[model samples]
Target: MTASPSSAYPYRLRLPGPITIPERIRQATARSIVNHRGPEMRVILEEIQQWIKPLFGTTAPVLTFGSSGTGVMEASLANVLAPGEKVLALVHGQFGERYAQIARALGAEVDVIESEWGWTPDPAVIAAKLDKNDYRALVAVHNESSTGAVTDLAAIGALLRDRDTLLLVDSVSGLGGLELRQDEWGVDIIVTGSQKALMCPPGLGFASVSEKARKVIERDDRCARFYLDMRKALAVVDKHETAFTCPVSLLFGVHEALTMIHEEGLPQVFARHKRLSDAMRAGCVALGLPAFGDQATASHTVVVASVPEPLTGGAIVKHMYETYNTAIAGARNKLTGRVIRIGTMGLISEADVLTDLYFLERSLTALGHAVPTPGCGVAAAVASLS
Candidate 1:
């Protein structure tokens, strides 16, 4: 059982994004593609509009784009930022840094306030920065996937409530799994992808826009834009149309995914994610791999742990994939080869978490790392799930 794909054709996707799609959602995606501008497509878009609102906790228009979450991140910046405008970015991990980069690329003078990897930025610190200087917007990641650290969006939003800065959040991996009251939190814009907690395949990006953000977008004409322009997207939102050609198959999958989520009920859906997160953290800690970030603010969507001494994250990831047909992800950039991330988002269940922990324990022991007990990790996971 070398690191080869011998019989791993249908192996589980335990990574953060591009999660294992449920059978029904896959079947929906396999259905024949429909015309993008047809009556059927219009109805699908209309239903999506209704289904996606509660996920973001917003009644504001959620503009969809035929791109990844990164595309919508760029769209959010391109729409509201004028050239040479000063923006403040709170950075903690890879995704947070990417948001800052997008702002800089859009010609905004971005001032980044960074925290150590695996930890979230403090809201008080953000408040201090905002009070000291005037920024056009404050950008942050609702969930830092690389470190499995979830930011306190509501707290951060409270700081900006009295300020003039717009609250732009990248909830690509957080929207469905975590609690996000976009409008209630005063979040000006929220960008998300279909792949993470939504249980759909990639290729669809969404942005929930508030009136304040819309006003900034409407006034900004400094950046060059065509397909990513929010004004054009908003204009046709009421008509159930997109400015560009839509990904009809992906939309079908999203519709099915949202239906499943709705059937489960939003509160239950969030509780499920919280339960999964608890189980994953317990299992990993029992295996001598404590969570990498602040446990108090750990993300419900993914669990990250630093690999133990005398073993590399790559070796563990490889062993799990090659020997057990399981797939987990390693940390990015600064923490590369140091930590492993296990996703608890989307359609993952208790059985799946237990199986993952069982194999993960095996992988650790096989890689010359000692496990405290033979079945302790799985046992702890069971206890947490119960």
Candidate 2:
């Protein structure tokens, strides 16, 4: 029988996220509750804004959501764009399409600029799409996590900076881990989750909004959302409180996680993630598994590699998780058994990468693939790190 949810599974790690939290943050998550409206909580809230601002590249206070990153994406759409406004939602993967779905559900006339699963939406193509339609906003994912494809937001931003449309970015997996400058990129709205690169478990999410988007939200009386109304939520910003009761425990954990990020420094933190990603890509190369896309657009967050003929992604994932108890993510839904997705997103070092590589090589070998050089994958990875 499988281990119970609460039971400790026999694995070195479980996931890229809900990733192994530092012991201190884990303890903080379990700490005694504080009143969400109390003075102590106010201090925590104030500190969180200060702690999180640099990550989002915003001087304006970031809005916190008591849900997943998708929640923030939906909330952002609901709060800013009104009914009948056209939104160009770029789709390169599942999450990108998700943003489109949310827009469609909310009555926005959605136009999609789609690319193949393993490729990122081209900025020039997107720029042309914008010119063809008088779009109110452009919804794009900075890093297409589902396919391990990274979009060129900087180039996209350069094209749109002087345009009339707003740029709403879903940087859920890219924000803290990858290089993202919301303000510098002229991203009107940016959303991210706590689980990915924040070194915390999933629980809360937040959005950083620019002045233009804030005004658009303030003036869009047609927007009927109550809970996600940034106007309502920001009403008490000076008081360091939210529109509703906040999750104090998750806030504690996020704050602790942000503290850890600060300790590492953002530049070094991003570099560490890059190092881990490089090692992962190198190891995959040594295993004779080609990456899903070229290195230029590859995600620093995760490595998506094509599963060779006769070696199903399902079998390897099953063997890794069930037999070795080392969990790695699989493909985007449509091509489930065709590709394997592995993440080095949060709280992982070279040692962790080595361990995961060892398991992946062994899993492939056990499944009848030839590892011409038994330890080469790990060696390549280690050399990349050094």
lDDT of 2 by residue, 1-386 (tens): 55433224466563545567778888989989999999989998899999888988878768887888899999889888889889998898989999999999888999998898878887788878877888878899988877888888778778778887888899888878887777787888888888888867786889888888888888756457988888887778768998898889999998898888899899998898899999998998899788886678888888888888898888888888876778787764887887887878878878888888888998899999998699988999989988
Give one digit per residue, the lDDT tens place, for model 1 in 1-386: 55484384458789988799999999999999888999999999999999999999999999999999999999988888879989999999999899999998889998999999888888788888887888888999999999988888889889888877899999999999998899898999999999999989889999999998888888756478889999999999999999889999999999999999999999999999999989999999999998897888899999998887778888888888888778899965988888999899998889889988998998898888889989999999999988
Q: Total clashes, candidate 1? A: 0
At residue 280, give the lDDT of candidate 2. 90
What 10-residue stretch in candidate 1 is worst by lDDT?
Answer: 1-10
Using TM-score as the measure, the top candidate is 1
TM-score of each: 0.97, 0.95
| Candidate 2 Cα outliers beyond 4 Å, as residue runs | 1-9
Q: What is the C-alpha local distance difference test score of each model?
A: 0.90, 0.84
Report the C-alpha displacement of residue 206, candidate 1, in angstroms. Answer: 0.1
- Candidate 1 Cα errors over 4 Å, as ranges: 6-10
What lDDT is reached at residue 310 by model 2?
96
Question: What residue pairs are clashing in model 1?
Answer: none
